[model samples]
Structures are given as C-alpha cells and as structure tokens.
Target: MKFNKFSKCLQIGLIAIPSAFAMSLTYAQDAGTRVAVVNSEKVFNESNLAKAMQTRLQNEFTKRQNDLRDSAEKIKTAAEKLDRDSAVMNEAERVRRQRELADQDRELQRKQREFTEDLNQRTFEERAKIAEKANLVLRQIAEQRKLDVIMQEAAFVSPKADITDDVIKALNSQK
Candidate 1:
C-alpha cells in the first residue's frame, strides 16, 4: 500500500513540473522584452535633487537641534552641581535639591522626546519627497525607453540593465 502511494505521488509531481514549465514559457512569450533595473541607493546618493533636499532639511532643523543640545547641556550642568553640593547641605536642603533635579531631568527628557519625534517626522517627509521625485524620473526613463519593468536593488543586475545613471541625469536636469 505504501509503495502504491509513493508511486502515485511521484507521478503527480512529474506531471505538475512539466505543466508549470509550459505555463511559464507561454507567459514569458507574451511578456515584453525590454527590462531595466535601478540602484535606489545610488539614485538617492547621487541625485542633485536629493542633495538639495537634504541641505534644506538640515538648515530648517538646525536651530531646533541646537536648542535641544543646549537644554541637554543645562541638564548635565544641573545634575553635576547637585552631585557636588548635596553632601554639604542639610537633609531638607539636600532633599529639596534632589527633587528639583528630578523635575528638571524629567522636563529635559520630555523635551528630548518631543525633539526626536519632530525630527524623525520631518526627516521622513523630506525623504518621501526625494523618493517621489526619483520615482517620477524613473517612470519617465522607463517610458522613454519602452521598458516593460524596472526593478530596484536587484541582487545581480547586469550593467546593461542598470538605468540609474539616466534617472540621476534626469533629476539633475531639473536643477
């Protein structure tokens, strides 16, 4: 009984493999011949538009970032002073200073969290803008060259199939 089951399974597997291959061949024949690949990392790094956007974002956020740094420094200074002077104070004065330090530390932490969230949100927005612009250029290149498909970050794309330079050129031309 086991041998019969094994034979049946082997036959089914053999039939299915051939059928799958035939279907794939038919689909390949119907598909367009032109294909292209894009290196997304290269596009992001080399594009003039990306560079300009990064610079703009950095400038826009620099003041807030500096403020955060200043606040952090102030908190550090306060903590250091509390550590140095606590031993010299009376119990009530020491406790009061500790409480004040804790409050200041909590406030700084809250501000730091807010700063991080805002920075991350703005960075994402700027990156999305750069990606959208790069995609537009990619589409333009694909359409101009009659590409059936354009894959990004393929593991093994041939140099001939890489259209990243064209997309970067298109982006730079807009500048």
Candidate 2:
C-alpha cells in the first residue's frame, strides 16, 4: 500500500513540473509584457522634493526644539537648587519648592510630548505628499516606456531594469 501511494505521488509531481515549466516558458516568450523596478527608498532620500520638504520641516520646528531645550535646562537648575537648599529650609518651604518643581517638570514633559507628536504628524504628511508625487512620476515613466508593471519594492533588481534615477530626475524637474 505504501509503495502504491509513493508511485502515485511521484507520477503527480512528474506531471506538474513539466506543466509548470511549459507555462513559465510561454510567459517568458511573450513580448508584450514589460516589467521595471524602482528603488523607492533611494528616491525618497535623494530627491530634491524630499530634501526641500525635510528642510521646511526642520525650519518649522527649530524654535520649538530650542524652547524645549531651554525648559529642560531650567528644570535641571531648579532640581539642583532644591537639592542644595533643602537642608536649610523649613519643612513647609521644602515641600512647596518640591511641589513647584514637580509641576514644572510635568508641564515640560507635556510640552515635549506635544512637540514630538506634532513633528511626527507633520513628517507623515510630508511623506505622503512626496509619495504622491513619486507615484505620478512613476506612472509617467511607465507610460513613456510602455511598461506593463513597475514594482516599487523588490528583493533584487537588475541595473538595466531599475528606473530610480529617471524617476528622481523627473521629480526634481517638476515644481
């Protein structure tokens, strides 16, 4: 019984392999289908549009970042002062100062959180814009080259099939 089952499996595998190979050969021989690959990470990091957007975001957030730095320094100074003077102050005075320091620290943390959230949201928005523009450029290239498929991400792409440089040039040329 085991020998019969093994023979049947071997026959099925032998039939399937040739059928799959023939189908692949037929597909490969077709001249109408053209494929291309694009390095999206390279485009995003090296393109003029992406660089300009990064600069704009940096400028927009620079002031807030500096302010956060200043607030952190102030908090540090207050902490040090409290530590240094706590021994000489009355219990009530020490407690009040500690409470004030805690409040300031919380407020600073809240502000820092808000700043980080805002920066992340803005970065996401900017990335979306860049992706939209890149897609447009990619479609244009695909049409111009008569490509049936243009993959943005691939495990491996040959230099002949990579249209990343062309995409970057097109994006940079646009307003």
Candidate 3:
C-alpha cells in the first residue's frame, strides 16, 4: 500500500507540474500579445541574392558540361578510328588504345566529381549567407514589434497568423 501511494504521488506530481506551467504560460501570453513568423523559403527564393547564386551555379555547371562533352567526343573519335582488323593491329597498339580510353574515362569521372563538390560547396556558402541575412532581418523585426515569440511560418501546424509580409518588407528595406 505504501509503494502504491508513492507511485501515485509521483505521477500526480509530474502531471500537476506541467499543468501549472501551462496555466502560467497562458497568463504570460495574456499579458502581452506580440508574435511573428517568417517564411524563410520564400525569402530565399525571391531574394536577389538567390538570383545571383543561381547565375553562378549555372556558369559552373555549363563549363563542366562543355568539358565533359569535349572529352566524350575525343573518346568517340578514338573509338571510331579503331581498326577492327585484329589480324593487322599489333597487341601493343590495341593495349595502348584501350589504356587511352580508360584514362579518358577516369579523367571525365574525376572532373564530374570535382564539379559536383564545387557546386555543393557554392550552394552551402550561398545559403549560409542568405540565411544569416534573413535571420538578422527577422530579429530586427521582432525587436521593433516587441514580439515575445518569433517562429518559422512553415513550422506552425495551424498557421493562425502569417508575418511573412512584415518580414519581407524588413528584408527588402535592408536591400
């Protein structure tokens, strides 16, 4: 009976603490009603910074693609030049051609990987810059409005309100 009472008291305490905290939060919220939210995705997509980053990414991709095409063309040419007359071609010549093709393939693969890494790194840097700038704007807006809480609009389940416009105005003014 003593052990049962102890467990019941522990459970009651856990529930009571959370209930009290909830009531306190309600009271606090009632005292002042300042809140805001931002749509970061919208900011990143619509910002001029995003356009600049896209242009840079396109140039990098295009250059890499052109180089890969040139490599492929050279390999194709070599393949076309291969004499199917096995009887006429020496073993050394055949081995040399095979090695050349293998080397070209390796080079193409390496270039592709490097291009991918560069693109990824560039994207990381661009997003980091944009996110930092947006966050600063968000904080400024929150402070200006005396907001008690600022949240991501996308994260709110019901989305009772949207402060995207206010945030966007702040971001643009920072432009």
Top-lDDT structure, candidate number: 2
TM-score of each: 0.78, 0.79, 0.70
TM-score between candidate 1 and the true structure: 0.78
lDDT of 3 by residue, 37-146 (tens): 67777777777676677887888688777888898888887776775544578999888888888898898889888878988898999889888888887778778777
State which candidate has the highest TM-score: 2
Ten residues in sequence with the least summed lDDT for candidate 2 = 24-33
Can you write out model 2's per-residue Cα lDDT over 61-170, one digit (the tens) per residue?
99999999999999899899999999999999999999999999999999999999999999999989999999999889999998888998798889989999999999
lDDT of 1 by residue, 1-175 (tens): 9999999999999999999999987887688567889988887777887788778878988898898788888878978987898888899998887888788778878988987898789878877887898889888888888887899888798899999998888889985
Residue 22 CA error for candidate 2 (Å)? 9.8
Q: Name the lDDT value of residue 12 in candidate 1.
A: 100
Q: List the candidate numbers ranked by lDDT, top first.
A: 2, 1, 3
**Cα RMSD of predicted structure 2:** 4.3
Those runs of model 1 whose alpha carbons end farther than 4 Å from true positions after fitting are 1-22, 25-32
